[model samples]
Target: MKKMTAMVMALVMAAGMTACGNVNETSSNVGAKIENTAEVQTTDEQTEETQNSEGAEMSGIDGGWIIPDEIDMDKNPEARAAIEKTFVKMMDAEYEPVALLGKQVVAGTNYCILCKVTSLYNHTRQNYAVVYVYEDLEGKAEITDTMDITLGNTENGYAETGAENIEGGWSISDEIALDKHPEASAALEKARETLVGAEYEPVALLGTQAVAGTNYCLLCKVTAVWVEQPTYVLVYVYEDLEGNAEITYTTDFTLGDADEEYSETGEEKMEMPNPWVEYSTAEEAGREAGLAFNVPEKLGEKSIYLIQAFDGLAEVRYGTEDNEISYRKGREVDDISGDHNDYNENSAMEIDDMTIYLRGNDGKVFGAVWNDDEYSYSYYAANGVSMETAQADITALINENK
Candidate 1:
């Protein structure tokens, strides 16, 4: 569960002064020439001179940062192509070319372009960055600089934004609408399902890392089960390229006075998010998966049941603490149960006109699979329950739904 991506882009970027050639910060003291890059905004007051120019001309003043009269980067092919080609290998952020902010004629052409930054995993938050691309005479493009735009005060003093504060190459996202991003929200819901012993009320999305897919850092308020004592923790959720998302780790994060609570839906007794549509109670899971399965009374009231249904398959689990019995059923003629753990012994029996194949070590039947006239059914008991006991469990499982 502790899967963290290994990346070096942030490291190279941090050592930008020495990592590569031409990024020597020797082009022309940009920080000194511009005086203050943070105050440069492409507003109506600043773009007045270029408003009358042709082809979206640069507003560069005497080899310094230019407040362009017009941006419209879609109309600038070179800038767009440079950004696409240069950032093609970058997995940290998704950059969309916004406008050509300015240009400086140096040893090579330095094009300053404005871009909207978004996480590949979540696209609900709005972030902006200014990217500097250095194009040589040979037409090879490389990123010389990048600055995350903060509306008020700049954090890194007009230098590259993603390098300094990076921990494991995880770049912090700007302020977002906490509970809005669909993917992050879905990820939190799934992670919440794994938090069986505590109450984790979500606070905000802290940051993210782009790897094979994405990893999200979420701030949550965790109340230890039965203690009523609440504290803060940073929850990390990893989502793979194939859409399999899970909580990777949870570490204590002290927020001090910065922690906040997201808006509540005012729902009572809601242990799961979107209960009917996902892992939920028996009825909801059955309706969603389109399979009407039953929970046997034999499992007892103390049993903890988790149900989930989807296209072609419906699955349920009955368990208490460490002992679990998983049930799966579907109309498709395949092993809907994903477990393939080999059992040393195997036997067969006839139950309700269907053949049940029981498998276990030396005869303690821990697994059973069968096919009724209409559907394939499977169950796994990892608790070392006996054949007779499993038969009774299976009988109760079939008898109630019929």
Candidate 2:
């Protein structure tokens, strides 16, 4: 009986040990599976992060110019550094960035950035905008081009009120036949009349800008041969609501002249004097002058109130009574030379290969001597006008004859 009891106890102990070993094995397998799953998840996260980083690097640009919200300074370190270097080089000094006009990815890896910058140097403040182009090589940025974008106002060569309306609108091809556009042709004719009280052959329509209203600013080049050098007059036409355009401005920089300012509102309204004499036509005046004077029936936007022509001289009075132009072709007068000698050396300027004496005393005065061998051409302008304005006006008269 004692032997049987001991054997039963031993069998029970063996069964318990087997059960414990099986449980331990199952736990170890489960822990190993969990560890493998965690490793795979961590690897997948790392791969995704690397792909995102590479995508950002390949992205061409990470910032914008005009809208501030588009600029990402943190992620786009390369572009920011490139733009700063370009601005420093172009500006030639440390300049404060004002605002970005815009930016674009021109080609595959080429980018263009437009921004306004201000420079304070020598107590003068200058503000302007510039466009910079960058070429990307691998992951580096290289500057390609830098362009200045600034328009001139009345103080320069362009009109003050209407310049902004026409900028970048349409640049008329120099090759475009002027005769094809009647409106342009008419505008040229109108410009000639308003400019010099005559009609001139239109050389080319440089460009045209249509204003928000019915008005248009026509930039036309007229045929002119004042000096030995080929002379070209830039005529700015301010078209009115009635579709009639007049020369409100003129610029001829080659002659050392600034732009001429005309009526900003439109054509001038003038009343004739009590005793006014009108020629039937300008051709009649030309016939009277012996030399053909290419005079228009009207001077400026208004019709000529008086036309006086004599031997070797012609005068067309238009607009106000004080406003008039006199053309004389004859021997140089002795008194005129004495009057010219009165001007100091500092008051002399050359225009159309002719030396002109300027006077600032009693209104602005300009006197010039032109000799065509067969005839001597002399011109004079008074009443507070700039030297350049006088040159342009007189050059127009000389061009008509040539």
Candidate 3:
């Protein structure tokens, strides 16, 4: 990651969006540049460039960064001593060194250590971060920068599943719909009344986690008071049982070129976090899960896009995040997709000599579950539909002849 890249990009691009939370990607020096002088400077520098004087042409490396043969902390005591001297408790994030990634030699030594970051707010969620520690000729060590290594969800942006997170952690999932969640909408409005400087348009209701109170993570399209081009931010809000809500935190991210790309595609896109589920294709998922599954030519006459995964079990998704057909397949276990939500309607359809049970609200069908002697399977439609549509879709999935 480029240190001070944001500092330079902010001035270059006129940083339309900035946040009050942790700026994780390379914010070392803000106002000063690390010069080429022989002086052993130890403070965070402002320059985006990592300049190496003698090590430039040593290994066909054009970026002025070098990789030494030995980087073990035990082998290189400097690495161990440097972290001990520089590692400090952060406000929102804390880092534990995993290994020395690499190093750069400038006026002082800059070391990049791979670290496991524990969220101070939600201790249950942990992710990787690259920590940059600068050690000077005087043997003084100080942290210069940190870059979080987070991936985005395929449906939304990057993050693990909402089903996996606890309180204080951000669950960047596309499963929760903002339009369907009145509580999140209410909490956002409650917090928005207090936010005076920026305009936030809700993009996605990531999910809700409960600690002492309930925490809601939202993906919002942000525009400063100046109508200064829209940007994206993940806004965290806390709601008490009494319905009192307040903004807890905000972090900015970019998923693609522009915000309209999502609106145009008709997907409830999140900022650049990976889907909570592992992203893989139908064929790849079948290989990983050790089961051969078929894709429908047209599920209920809807030309759906299929993306499936093997996260403990097979999770197959069809259609967009808004109106999806969720299909799950695995060995020897079944319950209303593991959730306690009950549909008012339930029925059974005999297809290909297998009894496919269906469930939904009112007289429509939104859920279906069945099992062979070998495995259990389920299919759910986000928006309820006619029982024939569910049966047709199930037939298309199971019987290639249909």
Give one digit per residue, the lDDT tens place, for model 2 in 1-402.
112223234334434544454211110010011110100000001123323432112111223112223333333454566666442433222333332323444322333333333221111223232333343444444443333323222334344332244544544333334565677777656644523311244543445566642223332222222111221234455565566655444432111110112101011111111212246655666566555656444323535665655443444544556755444443323212112234432365565665554455544654555565555555544343556666666666666666
Give the Cα lDDT of each candidate.
0.52, 0.37, 0.52
* TM-score (all chains, Cα) for each model: 0.33, 0.25, 0.32
Candidate 3 residue lDDT tens string, 247-363? 654545321111222211112212222223454466666566566655664565465466654433456677778887877665544442533357787788799999888788888
Q: Give the clash count for each candidate.
A: 0, 1, 22
The Cα error of candidate 2 at residue 56, in Å, is: 99
TM-score of 2: 0.25
Q: Give one digit per residue, the lDDT tens place, for model 1 in 214-305.
A: 77766555553232224344556667777777765444311111101210111111111121234656676667656776666345433655
Model 1 regions more than 4 Å off: 1-278, 297-302
Instruction: Please give the RMSD to the true structure for each candidate, in Å.
Output: 23.9, 34.8, 22.4
Superposed by TM-score, candidate 2 places the C-alpha of residue 123 at a distance from the truth, in angstroms, of 61
Judged by TM-score, which candidate is best? 1
Candidate 3 deviant stretches above 4 angstroms = 1-280, 336-339
